[model samples]
Target: MRVALCQIEVGDDPKENLQRMIDALRGAPEADLAVFPEASMVRFGNRLADVAEPLDGPFVTALRKAAREHHTAVIAGVFEPAGDRVHNTVVGIEATGEISGSYRKIHLFDAFSDRESEDVAPGAEPVVLDLAGTHIGVITCYDVRFPELARALVDRGAEILAVPAAWAQGVFKEEHWTTLVRARAIENTTWVIAVDKAPDRSRPPRGAPGGVGRSQLIDPMGTVVADLGPFPAVRVAELDLGVTERVRSILPSLTHRRPELF
Candidate 1:
């Protein structure tokens, strides 16, 4: 399967952000799937509820059209209204312009002195979407820190994991991002397509919370297939699915799980 890691910078304007997404898809190379960063709808530090929309709203509607036009399935983040707070959602759209699945982030980012729950509500379940016969699991930014979530998705027959993150820059944050992404793929024995927002150049270097790009794809054996550096760019690479089976045949870690003991 060919996948595109769209490491584009996210802005506060939903309309502009949507246009940026469309532009990225329009320029991306031929691929089966394209993944965007968390909060692709609008960047953080702004009032979320004011711009939050439903799954069938204009943002997703436009995405459906773009996905159909580009002939590539897309997994991008958006904010959905959930009463008082918004749900940080990742929507999956197929190449046929159908809504494949949606995953709300269960683990909100409440660490590092920032409280995400203050504005965002938590999700209850994990979501897996099928694209060209491959089952891909969806996970948000902070959720990457939790291995249990990845395990649950893998248990549900997910062969690939999609992580869309707007990981903030801080002390050792980049290390954490790279390590966690590789760890999830290595342990789950599944391919991981981890995409993060390119750093917003408008903001002063140490001014506010923002993304540190470093978007990458890791194979089941934890090999880095493609890594897009900290810049606004899109890169596509063909993923050999057979590698998963080959790695599993040697490791067999998933089958060796002693679930009853845990």
Candidate 2:
């Protein structure tokens, strides 16, 4: 299947971000699925409650319309407001304008004294949905660092893993991001498609200068099939799920694992 990864700069305006994503989708031909970055509806790291929207809000409605018009499945992130609490959530929209499922971010980003847990409630479940004949698992931002979440999805019959992140700029996070994504693909023997936000200067002190963009598509063998560098653009790649079977048949790593000892 062909996948489109959007790497765009998010700003303070949620409407502008949503419009940009829609415009980006127009440039690509019909794809089986399209993935956008975490908090695609609003700028990231500006406090969860400030940008939270309800599940039936205009942002989600726009996504559903876009999916139906383009005849493609979409997985995009938005800050979800439920009563008094908010959660970092990714919503899945089918081609028929149906709301398939949603995955709230389980692993909140709390590094470097930034306490996300204060505002956003952690998700209790890992979401896996079927998209165009492929079973895809959905995860947001910091959730990529947790291997158990990815493993659980894989065990539940996920052939592809999608991660949408608004990764901060600091230290060696760029290197770690790529390494961890590739590792997840290799270990699970599944395709990994990670879309990240580009750094913006207008946001705040929390918004640093560099995220490197570095959006990538990794094959089951941990090799990068396609990469979009530190710039704003759309990346498209064709991934064959058959590769998973080929890699597993040769190594048989999953079947040979001794989980009882570990």
Candidate 3:
């Protein structure tokens, strides 16, 4: 199936951010699945509480409408309310505009002196959504650091890994993002679709690091099938599910794992 990665500029306004997301999805090229980066619903700017909303609220409702219009399954991030804090969530909406499932970010961003857990609650479960005939998994930014999460999704019959991220820009950050994305695809023998914010190449945010775009699609053999440079854009690529099976047939790493020892 084909996928569209929407790399948008997530500024500080919740209203503008939501409208941008809608516009991107509506104008997306023909693809079976459309994915957006984390915090695409609204810019948290480190203050998630101020912009968090319910799953069935305006943000998702608008997304569902766009998905129905484009006739493509949509996967994007949203800040779902979780008690006093919020959950960094990536939800799946079918082409029919039905809610498929949601994956709350298990690995919150707690590195680089930023305390994500202080404002966002951690998720307890991993989720997989079936798009068309392909079994796809979902995870947010930091969760991509943990191989176990990807393994669990593959174990749950996921053939593709969808990562919606707002990867922060910093020293060695770009390298880390590319390396980790490719590693996940190689090891799990799954298609990896990672969408992140477009970095301001000329300037950083408030003299602080901002999101690094570099949205990419990796084949099961770890091939960089498509890469959207650090800019606001929409990238579409077709991923064949058979490639995952073919790679697994040669490597068989998933079945060869000694889970009991590790």
After superposition, which runs of candidate 3 have C-alpha atoms over 4 Å from their true positions? 200-207
Report lDDT per candidate. 0.91, 0.84, 0.84
lDDT of 3 at 26: 74
Worst 10 residues of 1 by lDDT: 200-209
For model 1 the TM-score comes to 0.97
Pairs clashing within candidate 3:
none
**Among all windows of ten consecutive residues in candidate 2, which has the lowest summed lDDT?**
203-212
**Steric collisions counted per model:** 0, 0, 0
Scored against the true structure, residue 181 in model 3 reaches a CA lDDT of 94
* C-alpha-based local distance difference test score of model 3: 0.84
Alpha carbon lDDT of residue 136, candidate 3?
A: 85
Which rank order by TM-score, best down to worst? 1, 2, 3
Q: Candidate 1: lDDT of 6?
A: 94
What TM-score would each prediction reach against the true structure?
0.97, 0.95, 0.94
The top-ranked prediction according to TM-score is 1
Which candidate's lDDT is highest?
1
Could you give candidate 1's per-residue lDDT for residues 194-255 as a string of tens digits? 99999877763223668989999999999999999888989998888899999999999999
Please give the lDDT score for candidate 1: 0.91
